[model samples]
Target: MSRTDEHRRLAVLAGIDIDNPELRAKLDEVSARTAARLGQPVSLVSMVLDGAQFFAGSFGLQGWLAELNGTPIEWSFCVNAVQSRTPYVVTDARIDALYAANPLVHVDGLHRYAGVPIVVDGEVLGAHCVLGYEPGEFSRSDLEELRRGADEIVALLASHRLPRAAPLPP
Candidate 1:
């Protein structure tokens, strides 16, 4: 599927309020715990919306990106995972052809990233990812930890979703 199609589907499936304090707090806790588990300073439960990559949960983020809780889809690496429905890892975005023009690589100095697709109800939503300012590798075990974190985040999101209405009586 096209990126736009994927994003549109995700936006519909992820109907929970991003601004809900209770949900955001729970997501933030997951991000923080995942960051510690992976020994990374930064982690995010990022959702690729139709127009932006929203940080549904974030840890160790600073400055404007953190303040905004998101960025344009053009600036997002998580979108890669969403599109591919697979993990996206960049050991050094600075030199990676795919990210050479991405603003976050040059402007934010984010050189490393490892992300797993966040799938809920069998649809790819976005990513659960770790960020690093310096170049590095993500071991297989690290990806597994991220996968577990993604599962936890999916559960949190599901809990916040509004229940389906009962079918109308004939």
Candidate 2:
């Protein structure tokens, strides 16, 4: 099987439903703490699946999309962090050519984004990330902490063995 196929399959085997309301209270604490630690208003713990990204936990996301479950990866900057297996950041999507045209920037008007991969046994599952509407620089130490937070998220996922979550709504 292809690595992509295996990655998707293992994601299923891990059995994390970050969006499950029953699981949110605990995950929400982690997310809220992550946001406080990173000093960002927007933070998310997400899992990448076949074509979309699921936010199992988050903070500072208000409005209609706040209740929405997932979004296509094409609309997610976390894709960069997951693919690289490292922290990815766009300090200013408005000024960065790489993200200048991204739908999250142009459509959602998000200006800053940063994330670290959620790696399990050498495979990237998805990302733990932060976002903001204002541009800001992240120090090397900040990136390191985000990476550590991603590791903590992995630990949390490993400690639980719940049933698989339903796929994102079509």
Candidate 3:
């Protein structure tokens, strides 16, 4: 299967669409704590899917971006984090030519970024991202802490009884 296809498949198998309010609350707590710890204005635990990303948890996220459960992958900076397979940091996207074209950088005003892959069963479930509205440096210790926090988030996900999509009534 194509990588995107496999990602979607594994996401479904891993209960990425879980609707458990209890678990969602925990995820929300994670998001809040991450944003506070990183001193970032926004943080999200996103599930990167085929064409979009669903917010499993979030903090300080709003606006038109607030109205939905997820967003198109093209608009998601965390997509890069999920693909990186390691903690990724963008010191300054606005001034960085490499990231100048990223929609999240130029369009949304999300500047510096630090994130880590959230893995389960050796598959990338999605990513945990801390988005700063201004350029800033992320130290190695900061990145390592982000990775550790991601591990804790993964632990919460792993311990849950994966609730799958229920079959539609005939």
Candidate 4:
């Protein structure tokens, strides 16, 4: 599909408003499990939108970011995972040219990241990710854990999604 078509589809899916207590609870559980499994400081179920990336589920966040539950897309590594349609890993964003200047590296002191795309029905919607304050390698096993967490997140979203209406007869 074209980029425009993809964006439209994303808008429609996101417009259903996946924000709810039950979904959040389940997502938080997934995030916690991912963080523990990977030994990371934080985990997030991050959905990339047109303007911002919303944290559908998260753990180990503090301060204003935790309260806000999201940030502008410019600050998101999860966007890369969605765009690549595969796992995206950064050993150290502070040293990587592509991410060296990103505010999250400088301001938040977040260096390491591993993300797996959350895909459903052939469309990549977002990413499930783990973050760290220090630079380090993420093993293949780490990525695999993230993939499992991503799958769980997708299942939770599918269950909570609003059913689409059928098309009219021609």
Candidate 5:
């Protein structure tokens, strides 16, 4: 697909609202469906802000998720998505000069990655990404779907007004 088409698709997908209760449920449902439909190993809703990564929801694969919560920016693809403010799709991390040496790509053997940036009101918040153990490529439709999913996640966060949890008095 053309670059413009990709960006436009991302924008359209990012416009979905995930804050509403029904919408949030739908987002989760769709995420699960997408994972199955795409035959991917893992699908996740990730939010990046400042230096932390939050897992709003996930489907497929387990373990290390809790540890990943509130993780630093350096170890995350979501962070890279936000910093670059674009969708990153790596068909083969092992062949990519930039990511080949990255621990997540090398040691973890996460060879394939597809991530779309989540932006709200002109500010990049995080990303929603899908990963696989083997190298793979995503079609335009796949990228658009991922972008929409990410947008829904952003909307969910935006709808909530709860204050950030404060630590108890020590």
Candidate 6:
């Protein structure tokens, strides 16, 4: 299928959120589908601000996500995409000058990464990223599909603000 077609399919899938439970289910389904379609091991939807990373959705790979939260901005590929406000594809992180030493790349053995920046109202919010153990190349179509998913995530976050928990009794 064409990239635009794939993106449209995801957009339709994302449009089904009625509440938190539904949203979470759609996110999981989209992430899994994206991974399956792209033949990748890991697919992630993350929101990266100045100093924090939040995993809105993810598939494949556990345990390491906790480490990603509150991680330094400089160590993340998603941060790079957010800063640049563009798609960043690393075919071989071990060979890239900027990411060769990054813990996610070197220590974790993530050789391939493709990230599309999530921009909402002209401001970058975060990114949708996919990774693989072995090196891989991303096509323009793949990037566009990722971008569509990121846009949907931004919209969802905007529409449904997470409620703040009440304080404990004094």
lDDT values, one for every candidate? 0.87, 0.77, 0.78, 0.87, 0.69, 0.72
Q: What is the C-alpha RMSD of each candidate to the true structure, in Å?
A: 2.6, 5.3, 3.5, 2.0, 8.7, 9.6
Model 5 agreement with the true structure over 137-168: per-residue lDDT tens digits: 99988888897777676666566534445778
Which candidate should be chosen as best, given TM-score against the real structure?
4
Looking at model 2, the pairs that clash are 18-56
Cα displacement (angstroms), candidate 4, residue 32, comes to 0.5
Show the lowest summed lDDT stretch of 10 residues, model 3. 9-18
Per-residue CA lDDT of model 3 for 95-126, tens digit only, reads 87667887777777888888889887777778
TM-score of each: 0.89, 0.82, 0.83, 0.91, 0.70, 0.74
For model 4, what is the C-alpha lDDT against the true structure?
0.87
In candidate 5, position 23 carries an lDDT of: 51
Write out the backbone clash pairs for model 3: none
Rank candidates, TM-score, best first.
Answer: 4, 1, 3, 2, 6, 5
lDDT of 4 by residue, 24-113 (tens): 999999999999988998999998887789888999988777998998888889989988898999999998988899888898899999
- Better structure of 2 and 4 per lDDT: 4
Clashing pairs in 6: none
TM-score of 5: 0.70
